[model samples]
Structures are given as C-alpha cells and as structure tokens.
Target: MTVENEIELTAISGRRSTFEGDPRPGDTLPSMKDSPAVEAGSTMTMTPGLEASRDQLQLQENEEHSIEVLPPVDGGRQAWLFLLGATYMEMLIWGLPFSIGILHVYWTNTLFEGEGASAITLAATLQTGLLYMSCAFFGPMFAALPRWTKTLQVAGLVIGSASVIASAFVTKPWHLIVTIGIFYPMSCACYFPCATLLFEWWHASRGFASGMMYAGTGAGGTIFPFLMQGLLQRFGYKAAMVSLGVGYVVTGLVALIPIKRRIPLSRYDQDGISRIRPRIDWAFSKRKALYLGIMVIGMTSLGNFVPSLWLPSYVDDLGLNKPNGVALVAILNAATALGNGLLGWLSDRMSLRSTILISCVGSAAACAFLWGFGKNSGVLVTFAIIFGLLGPSFSAVWSKIIHLVSKDDPAVTALTFSIFAFVRGVGNMSSGPISESLLKYDTMRGVIGAYGYKNYGILLIYTSITILTGGAAGLFFNKIRDV
Candidate 1:
C-alpha cells in the first residue's frame, strides 16, 4: 500500500469511532467533536491507550487553532502596521545613542572641556552596551509574561523620555552618564524587545521586515545628528536635549498604538490553570556553534561603534569645520540605513554566513585602507560612507543568526537572540576601555608612515584586525549546519 493509504489505515486502527461508514482515501477523518461529550463537571476516566489518543486529538486541535488565529505572514494591514510601529520604536531607541558622536563633539568643546576621550566615550558606550545587554533579561521576561508586553513598553516610553529631559539639566559629565547611559538604556530594555513581536507577524519575509525596522536607527542617526547640531548651535545643548525628550514622548505614544502581540495570551494558557513558566533552552548554551557565533559577534561589535563615537571628533582633529563633521556623520548614517536594508535582503536570498562574511571583510578593508590613510575631508567622507555601508550594520544579520542558533526551532529563537545580544553587549562595553588604551599611547608614532604615525593608528589597526577575525568565523558555517 502507498504511504498515504498506510497512514489512513494506521489512523483508523488507532481510534474506535462511532461512524458506520468505511473510510475512503479522500474522506474527512472523524473529529473529536463527533464523539460523545463528558457531562459538565463529570470526571471521565479511560484506558491508557484511550487517554493517549484523546491527548493527541487535543494537540492537533490546538495546532489547527494556532494556524487559524495567526495573521497572514509578510502581508496584510495589521502586519504592515506592526512593522511600521516597530520601525518607529527602533528610531527612538537607537537614534539618539548612535548620534552621540555629535554630542561628543559639542561636549568636548564646551561642557567637558579638557576631559579625556575615555570619559565622554564611556557614556555612549554604556548606552550602547545596556541596549544590547538588557535584551538578555528582557527577552526572558517577555517570553514568560507575553501579556505584559504592551504595559512594559508604555512604561519604557515614559521613562526614556523622562531620562532625556533630565539630561538637559545635567551640570557634570557623570550626570550625562546617569541620564543618557543608565536611564535611557533602562527604558530601552523595555521598548526594544517589542521588535520580536514581528516574528509573530511575519515569517517568510522576516529578514526583510527586521531590516526595515532597524533602518529606523539609521534614519534616526542620520536626522538626529543634523537636528542636534542645529539645535545645539541655535538653542544650546540644554534646549536641544529637552526638545528631543518631548518629541520622543509625543511620537512614541502614537507609534505604540499599532504595536501588539500576534497570538493572544489565552492561547498559551488554554486551561487557565497552568502557570506560565519561562522556557529556558540550556542546551543551546552548550553548542559550539553558539560560542563561535558569539565570538564573531563580539569581535565585530568591538569596532562597530568606533566610527560613530570618534569620527566627528576625528574630523575636528583634522581641522574640518563643525558643519563638515556633522555632514560626515549624517552621510555615515544614511549609508548605514541603505546597508541594513540591502544586507537584510541579501540574507533572505543567500546563505547568512556569506552575507556576514562580506560585511566583515568589506568593513575590515575600509578601516585598514580608507580610514587608516584618510587625511582630508574627502577621504574621511569616503571612509564614513563605505565603512558605514559595510561595517556597522551587522545587526541586520541578527535574524539569520537566530535562525541558525535555534536550528529553525521557532520556540527558542527569542532566547537565542537574547544570548547573542548579551555577548555583543559585553564586547561593546569593553570597546570603550579598549579604545581608551589604544588612543592613550602612540607606539607607531614616527616609525610608520604618516597614516600610521597619526595618533589614531593603533585604533584603526585594532579595529581592522578584530573585524577580520569576525569574518573568519564564516569558514565554520558549514560545520554549524552539520551540528
């Protein structure tokens, strides 16, 4: 008999049915709805075989219910709206932090004159680090309490806005750390996890959708630098910070309206008595592929923020006017936006490892060649655009990373993403101290060419090497599949 016929026979023999008609190949199978119901509140007992059959029927029903309830993936009004909301969230959560280069320029010249680069860079680093690190905690929190997502997001919006507003009143550098670094990132931990909701809404086009969402960061970074620069020039940093905070509150509230969970909380708690337990995938922690991927992510992350935090200052060091520096930062951000979308689309079409390899190798080349030797505004601008395009947008590969780490198991994807985020966070946090040490001493001075003799030679070489190592991890992609 054919496989289909065999399955039909097996199913028929497994269940004792009330139907009198002999089942045909194409006939609809008997459903539990046709079976006699246990009276309300009456305990029903059955043989072990019967109990197993009933449990199987219930599981099949639940699976069918889930399919029917989920919105169509990659399209439909609700799905697109959710994407739009997520994009806006990305803008507010990441835009300000990415544009810290402009603030670094302003503060060094005025508020924190004579302060070392490490102190200023620390706040920005903390902001970036917390944004990534918090994912480890918040990812699990959301998984455990999916119903509270909207509430937590709303709270985050308020806290983040307040933190920015508070930064306006800061009189010292540490104040900026508390407001911008600590409070803002704390709020981000709440808001950023909402991006995972897109997984529920889009599957086929998830990479594309995530790319579009992260493009918001690029959008924000592009516009905010210009905006903050203009604001600081005209109204001063105090007014500029306050205005951004107010703007975040107004815009964030509107964006939150469309954001929501795909599946209802009740669906996961069918009996209304089962406690919602956190599903921790400890086995994922033991996988060699996981560690290799983390190392790759960590290495790339070490240099990811170098340009964003220092490029504007580097422009100043080169004697470029403030406007030129601002413009360079804007160009970098615009290129980043393009890169995120393009790489995301590429991941959907090609092997994710290939896309990651391209980003790392290209970024390394830009840093070692274009950025290291850059001497004038023209070279700096070219470096910014190219490096932004190839380097900083590695976050776009996250969806692919999650897919690989989870081995295509949807249930563990979020936790895997969280773990990767934590690893990247550690790398980001360390980059601040690492950059400090690199810039503190100039061993290459007078020994190498003018480019290497330049103060930032150590920083550039370090960035390039780390990025190359990250790219080398791609060699093991085939091994990951074997695992």
Candidate 2:
C-alpha cells in the first residue's frame, strides 16, 4: 500500500540513478498525516550502499521538536568566540597544508634533491587527501558522541603536532609521507565537527560565519609563505619543521579553548552510539541535482590544486628568485581569503548556480589567458592572485549547493556533505599524479617562454579545460534553478 505523500525511489548497488526536470512517473510526496506512528527514541540503521530511500517528506519546517532549550542562535559571545578559534586554526594549522608549495619546492631542489618529483608530490597529495577523507569518518563520530568533542579536538592536535615534529627526522621520502602527510592530517580531522557546532550556535548567520572561517585559510596562505620562507632559508628544512610543530603545540591549545558546544551533553540522544562508523550512505543520491553536484565537485577539485602544486617550479623556470615565488604564493593566498568572503556572500543573495558559474568562468579564464601565456614574474604573480580568488573559493559555496539539492532537509544535508567531501578528496589525491603526467615535455625550455611553452604548456591546457568542464557540469543540477 502506497502512502499519500511518500516517494519511494530504489537504488541499485554500485549504480547511480539519473533525474531530469520532472519527477519520473509514480512519484509523490506523502503528507505527514499519512505516515505511521513511531515509538519515541527509536532509531533506524542499515547497510551502507544497499539501502533504499522511501522519503517521509517534510517539505517545510513548520515546527521544531526538542526536549531542551539550547543557547541563542545567530549572535552571542559564545558564537563569536567559537568563530575566533576556528579562524585561528584555519590560519595556522590548516594554513600549513595549503602553503605546502613552498616546502614542496625546497624538498625537490634541496632536501630530497635529485629524487623523482613523483615521490615528493605524493606527500602533498597524501596530506590533502587525509585532511578531507577524515570528514567522512569523523563527522559522524562527533554526532554520535557529542560529549567527546573536546577530547577529540585535543587528541587530534596532539597527534598532528607530534606527527609534524616527528617529520623532522625522516630519512626517506616515504617517511615524510607517513609523518607529515598522513599522521598530520589525521590530527586535523578533529576540526570537522566544528561544522555541526557552528550550525548549532549560528543558525541565521551560518553562511557569513562559514565565509569568515574559510577566509582565515587565505589569511594563513598570505602570511605563512613569507614566514616559512624566512624560516627555511635561515634554519634549514628540519629546523623549520620542528619550529612549526612547536608553534602548533602552543597555539593550538589556546585556539581550541573557545570552541564550545551550544547544546548540553545531557540533552543529546546518544542511542547505540558505539555502532557508528564513517558512513557511505548514498540513499539520497537518487536526486538528479545531487548526482550532478557531485560530478561538478569532483571535476573542479582535480584542477584546484594544480597552481599550488606547480607555481613555485613554474616561476623557478622563469628565472625568479625564491622570494619571488614566495611573494606570488602569498599574493594568491590573500586573494583566496577575499574570494571566499565575496563568493559566500554572493551565494546567499543570488542563485548558487551563478556563484559556481563565476568561479568556473573566472578560474578557467585565469588559467588560459593569464597562466598559459605567462612569461615573467609580474604575469605569474597576476595569475596567482586571480586564480586563487576564483579557484579554491568555489568550495566556499558548497553549503548553498547542498541546501538546494536537499531542499533544506537536514538529514540529507549531512550525508550529501560527506559524499561531496569524499569525492573532492578523491579528486584532490588524483590530481597530483595526473598533473605530473601532464608535464610531459617543454619544447620552449629557456626560450622566451611563449604561451607557457617554456615548461608547462600541456599542463596549463589540461588545467583550464578540466575547470571549464566542471562549470559545464554545474549547469546540469536542476535544483539551483529555483533559487
């Protein structure tokens, strides 16, 4: 017997469904009155990929059910203090990973000098991959054990700091991957739960609050490059790594002190919490807008790290000094901060599709016209700033995209965030190798460096084209049209 407002969409294992403008025949949203009664405190659990979705639709939020009265939402000292801590972590701990380009250069030419670029690049990919991959696993843990939030954050910082300090002793390239690349990101994983916490503290101001946190990364990028450059030049890579690790130990403790939960631990419904694992729930993937959104995320992520991975080397070939490369990276990072704030605010006021379009078209054009033809320090620096603003800032618009896909349904929102994050993680890991392969041969080596032919002609083409395709992918998500 079919319920009046329910829509039953079955998903095949390992297969993705396609949706277009209209619902397929036999689809309807069952009214809440038609649904059967459920016992209080009951929970639903199922296998990961094999589950079917029979959505008990709530198309609008007419009421909220809760046993406890939480703190205020949107504005308060707790909210602002939490943002300050998050922004601080974003600037320092997270900033180091994004600023890896400078160290990447030093590693290739000085530390592991003469080693294959492929092995060195693996360190970058590994850290970035783990940083995102943790979102899928750790996000739910915090939900399951909200009381463990402080412990988890403290533990993650200790592990990440120890990993970085340990990295100073690596004798082989793979050892660097283990310490700095893998373990360090594992520590950063603790940061993911803040999303849930932020939502709790600032319901109305979520978008603006998120933009502020993301902009901190840009701020870190701007400052860290020069700071790191000075350290590495004066103290050597080992000392630089140790100093940074020590800084993390001191700063992280102070920074994390303000990140408090809005809801009391006693109020949470922690039924069967131990059974939770990093979920792979694709039950909601039947939406056409969702699958299309995933494709866009994966495609853009493939190109997102290209500039950071290759810019230092690209400028080295341009006959620029180490400081010039540092300057370019810093400029790029500062622009990224501005881009995050700008793109996020725009997404709130306009269609999310418009923001994606802006990011894609602007980033692709930067790669093509500016990065591809660059032949001097000035041109490369301009490419850095423009691309930084348009490229990574696309990620800042993710919450809006997910909202459109889920129609503000909170259950689907969490799963979709993890799924999109995982895909982007996979894309980021895959880009290092793909880009290395793209560096095939540079015929214009040492020549006037026309059209980036000096060293990265093929790489530039691949980066720009893939980013454009992502924009094309963005056009297919149907939900954003309503916004």
Residue 102: error of model 2 in Å? 3.3
| TM-score to true structure, per model | 0.80, 0.76
RMSD to native, candidate 2: 10.5
Supply candidate 2's per-residue lDDT for 34. Answer: 23
**Against the unseen true structure, what C-alpha lDDT does each candidate score?**
0.72, 0.69
Number of clashing pairs per prediction, in order: 0, 4
Task: Tell me the spans in candidate 2 whose CA falls farther than 4 Å from its real position.
Answer: 1-69, 105-119, 236-238, 264-283, 321-323, 405-414, 441-452, 478-483
- Candidate 1 residue-wise lDDT, 261-293, digit = tens: 554333223375544444456677777777777
Candidate 2 yields a Cα-based lDDT of: 0.69
lDDT of 2 by residue, 1-483 (tens): 222343221111111111111223444323333222211342233334323344522421221322222344667676788888888877776777877877778878888898857777778768878787777777556655555778988899889989988888877778878887788887654566555456545544566777777888889888887788889989987898899999987898898888876543322124734232323445556667787788888899898878877777777776777446667777888889998888877777766667788999999899887877777777777888889888987777776666556544333455567677788888888888898876876644654344445458777777888888899888765444536
Most lDDT-accurate candidate? 1
The collision pairs in model 2 are 5-29, 5-30, 5-31, 6-30
